[model samples]
Target: MSALLVRHEANRLGRDIAVGDIHGHFTRLRAALDRARFDPAVDRLFSVGDLVDRGPESEQVLDWLALPWFHAVRGNHEDIAIRYAKGNPVDQTSYIANGGAWFVTQPLARRPVYAEAFARLPLAREIETPAGPVGIVHADSPVRDWSRLVWSLRLWRAARDRAMWSRDRLQGENADGVAGLRALVVGHTPVEDPVVLGNVHHIDTGGWMQDGRFTLLDLATLQAIPPMG
Candidate 1:
């Protein structure tokens, strides 16, 4: 692994909030931030990725990268987009079929730059705060032992891909816990509300749904900040 695979110390600031998959809909992001009275100067926003695709404003999702307070791990959708941008036709087809048709509409020249940026996104984030250390991953945190997972990441092993695409962890009757994590925060599994299984919490509420609101899980408070009306 290299620096890309190891756990780097997190930069803690005022208030740190973890957001579910945005899936584009940049306006909703704004609304959620506004509704929570998010102060960018004094607050921090962490994303679970899927920042683009399937919404009206997919193209604008990249703009969030410019914000100093915004941080994220790569979502599975972002993985596919990175592949497609890197000239992988298989991923292009898969991405388009999975509500990412707009990806093909973007100007070809800009995709390389976008793909480079998206590919550089971390696969996991561990933040140590006054509340304790919170871990964030896009989809699932495959291993129960966080150290084993970190080792796998450093070795560039098979478990790396599983972290971004696996849903089996959320399906079983067993309430498996990720060992050594205070709370493992995940997206990609949309629920009517936040679902807590052992130490794992799923916050992706399918905000694109008609009744959904972009959820911002406040780490300082460990509560979902209300979304816009």
Candidate 2:
């Protein structure tokens, strides 16, 4: 797959929902979808990634990936797993410290399968919505110009890494937002609630944590759907 994937005129017949970092919490995700009345037969779900690690059911990542209605971008945790699977230099200790124990403890033979599957995910995704084109990246965009980043991702390793790992936008609290796009949704930094800095939306509610709430943002409305009890 290309470093960036663009889907134009999507979800014409149904709603498009974008969710925060799942971090292996499938049960919570399912509940949230249920609350939102998500219908896989029509409604499509988009994830900002970090689909594995930090929560129970980490081993079920592959099954989730197989869902036709589910799409995801590559996140930092996935990046670490890919590097380890390729026998490339990776900080094993740090990876384990950051909720990667599930992956580390998996059978060695399974690493490649996970890596290959995750490698097919794009670092960033652009989906066309009625409001405009919305961008989804694991972390932050490389530059303020969303169009430029999309055009350069394949040849720009720096941009790809930034898309998966950078938190500058959140840290600096830059509200200028990206151009050439309606909104950019991301999920590396966990916020108490969905926070919108200009058009960049941070929706990772730390769903992997015991006290965290899994949030599902309506892509068409750019609003958080209140999870049903």
Whose TM-score is greatest here? 2
Candidate 2 clashes: the total is 0
Which 10-residue window of candidate 2 scores lowest in summed lDDT?
1-10
Candidate 1 lDDT by residue in tens digits, 1-229: 2133324244455678898888877788887798888999978888888888888887786678878788888888888888788777655566677778887777999887777778878888887666567888888886788867777766664576777877777777347778887788888878888888888888988876678767788876678877546
lDDT of 2: 0.88
Candidates' RMSD to native: 2.4, 1.4
lDDT of 1 at 49: 83
- Candidate 2 lDDT at 220 equals 88
- What number of clashing residue pairs does each candidate have, in the order they appear? 1, 0
The lDDT per prediction is 0.78, 0.88
Q: List TM-scores for all candidates, in order.
A: 0.90, 0.95
Poorest 10 consecutive residues of model 1 by lDDT?
Answer: 1-10
**Candidate with the greatest lDDT versus the true structure:** 2
lDDT of 1 at 101: 84
